[model samples]
Target: MNDMEEDGRRTTMTTTKTRGIRLAKEENEKTDVRKYIPPLDGQYVEKWLNDSQNPGQVGEELVKQQFLLDLLHSKISARYERGLETAEIDEHAWQVQNSITAIKRRLKQLVDTVPPVVSLETTDSRCIEMYEEKQLMATQGMLRADILEERQRVARLCWQLHNTGEDTKEMVNEDPKNDEQEWVERCKLEEAARSALLEEINRLRSTCADLRARLEMEALSNEVPKYDSL
Candidate 1:
């Protein structure tokens, strides 16, 4: 009776161990299968391509796809070099290659569908010249308008300062100069204010001149055609 009990306990332990090992193995296989699945699918690629509007968008997509292809190629190369090629790696590589091929084909189709650009030489020279002249005139007119507006602002500032000086003078005349020292101080303050205003006006005038010179230079540069080597 004691021997039979010990044998039964041993059998139960063995069965439990086998079951645990089998469960672990199956879990690992499922993980491997998930790992081999392609990150992107045909539907995703088709949607991406369709959403792209211009060559720039397609170019960006191609860059991302190329990066993935290089990564997959590297993985496959590393596996083969290390004698570790497996069905999983091969399947992943195949799926990635298919994606890459599809991307390239769509890009080619986009390129083919785009219309050829009209050459500048094909356009009428007279029309081009007129267009350039119109652009130049427009820029010059803007500059002139800006300069006139700035001049008007300066004029208004000057008028305001002049009126303030006149008011100060009137106040000084209206108030009796009982204190000579105070009168002298008042005059000194007025002189200082006037000098500061004049300095500011000078600075503004210098800035205006500099801006005008720059605008003229820009206009000249635009007028001169930059010839390219034939």
Candidate 2:
């Protein structure tokens, strides 16, 4: 009985070893099918799918690979399109930034070359003084013109008075009843009026000359550079 029991135990061990070997061989075959089948050939999916009833793990792998390919074709393609759009936006932004830089440079050049126009809002007291001086000069010019016109009228009146005096003298010589003293008084008054007109004309001429000189000086000063050049 001891020998029979020992033989039985040996038989069970042999069967267990045989079963384990068979399972290990089957596992190695499945691993070889997954690893050695060239995925790059693009035919593994077709072969695995041809035998659907017995496809096993390889079939499930083909299904998962097909799903991944579809996802890449749909989602990744959309991602590529979005990347292209993003690149275009970045390029446009770069161009806009360059344009803005160019505009700023052009504005700086303009500012350097041209002076700003002065207005009533200018803070410079010189500008105010120059404006007031110009107004004064205009007024002086008008006054000078009026004075010249008046001088011309006065000279014409003086000539007429001299001619009338000569005519009255001839009439007085022809008529002895004419008052000689009254004629002399009228002649004296005419001379005084002529003298006054001559003095006024001379005074106006002096004032005009002075005003013209002052105007010239003011214009020269105005044309002078206000600030030092860089």
The top-ranked prediction according to lDDT is 1
Provide backbone clash counts, one per model: 0, 0
Best by TM-score: 1
lDDT of 1 by residue, 88-109 (tens): 8657656766666677677767
- How accurate locally is residue 147 in candidate 1, as Cα lDDT from 0 to 100? 48
Candidate 1 accuracy as TM-score: 0.31
Per-residue lDDT tens digits for candidate 2, residues 1-230, read: 99999999999999999999999999998874534432222333344334434324444444444444444334533544443333443444344334333433444344446575544345356555655655554554555466557656767988997998788766636545456677788879988997897688668666665676567657857754465323
Q: Name the runs in model 2 displaced over 4 angstroms.
A: 1-124, 173-230
Alpha-carbon local distance difference test for all models: 0.64, 0.56
lDDT value for candidate 2? 0.56
